[model samples]
Target: MKKQIRFILTSVSILLSMFCGLENSYSLEENVKIEECSDLNCVRSHIDEINKGIVLLLAKRMQYVVQAGEIKLKNNIVTAYDKKRAELVVNNAEEFAKEKGLPSGFTKEIFQVIVDKSRDFEQIKMDKKSNLDKIKTKK
Candidate 1:
């Protein structure tokens, strides 16, 4: 069972490293550097880097959400919040967190916040596009 879990994690890590498309972003092990932590200051620095990385990832994700909003508008989808998809995302994050020995509920909460904000950003993008269309039509 341990081997299986390790294998799954390895596969996912490889895939993410290859396809995540974030330049200069380190993997989990590289980002943490537990062995190199000689003092509290070193640990704090690592934490800061990890936090910055999280923000960068969130920004990148929002960029895609913005594009998705535009595509939704073009295709006449008319809805920013897809309940099913949001649930799936949170569930998946929870499961992954469990596999990584993290608190599943905490992971679920974090993902829920992300999804809510993403929905809001998506809605805002759609509204701006709609307003632009209205202005264009009036001209």
Candidate 2:
């Protein structure tokens, strides 16, 4: 019974250590910072503007993706092309964020959101095209 108890405790300790290490790996301590702005309202406004710019860039990227989808459909190309493009966008965004002194995790999250949105958009476009084809066939 004593030996069994020690073995259980040692197993628990190893599990706990592994869990802590995994948690630390996912922690964003180095990626995000919160600091008090001297001019709170002004700083907020500036940040908002910067966010808007990023949004605009995201929009442009989505537009390009949509166009690519259209071209792919016309040329009998596969979604693999789009997947490659999306991966490049994510990589570039990560590099850009690091160069701009932005948090890499935050930047990556934003890009992932963009990628999700683009995928949704592409799906909708494909669905519409399929529907249109059905309508034409019916006609």
Candidate 3:
């Protein structure tokens, strides 16, 4: 229950931050009248800003992923990969993509990469914990 609540809260915070950041960027661009992007350089500049924002959001998401891995390790969860959770995540991403007029396949592929990396990180955390325990037991 606690884990579920924590997960939900983390998810909510992520969504909130994404939307807030998007809102700010949208408004800023609107103020600058850069949405039209008449020239190649202007379009490239806008793309650069978008990429930067995406990278920032991904960094924030990974921070939460580390926290989640720690929580799972402390709670004695055995595996980093949760099939049901992964499916739910993909499904949610697909739905969001539909709402935003993005390609479902593109969204699914992107999320699969994110989920795979998250699992790798979680496994690393679990492995580190296991190693520490083995060392402690030896002494």
**TM-score for each predicted model, relative to the true structure:** 0.75, 0.59, 0.71
> In candidate 1, which residue ranges exceed 4 Å CA deviation?
1-34
Better of 1 and 3 by lDDT: 1
Better of 2 and 3 by lDDT: 3
Model 3, residue 14: distance off in Å is 23
Per-residue error (Å), model 2, residue 102: 2.9
lDDT of 1 at 103: 38
lDDT sort, best first = 1, 3, 2
CA RMSD per model (angstroms)? 11.0, 15.1, 9.9
Clashing pairs in 1: none
Give the 10-residue window scoring lowest on summed lDDT in candidate 3. 25-34
**Candidate 3, residues 18-120: lDDT per residue as tens digits?**
4334544333223433365467687556555655676688779888887887788789885788889988998898787666544347567667777877788
lDDT of 2 by residue, 34-128 (tens): 33346758555644554465557756977887787777777765452356767887889789756644544655655665676677777678667
Candidate no. 3 TM-score: 0.71
Model 1 scores what on Cα lDDT? Answer: 0.69
Task: Give per-residue CA lDDT, model 1, range 1-139, as digits (tens).
Answer: 3453344344444434332233244333435323345676865565555556666787899999999999999899878999999999999988976665453386676677779878988998899899999999999
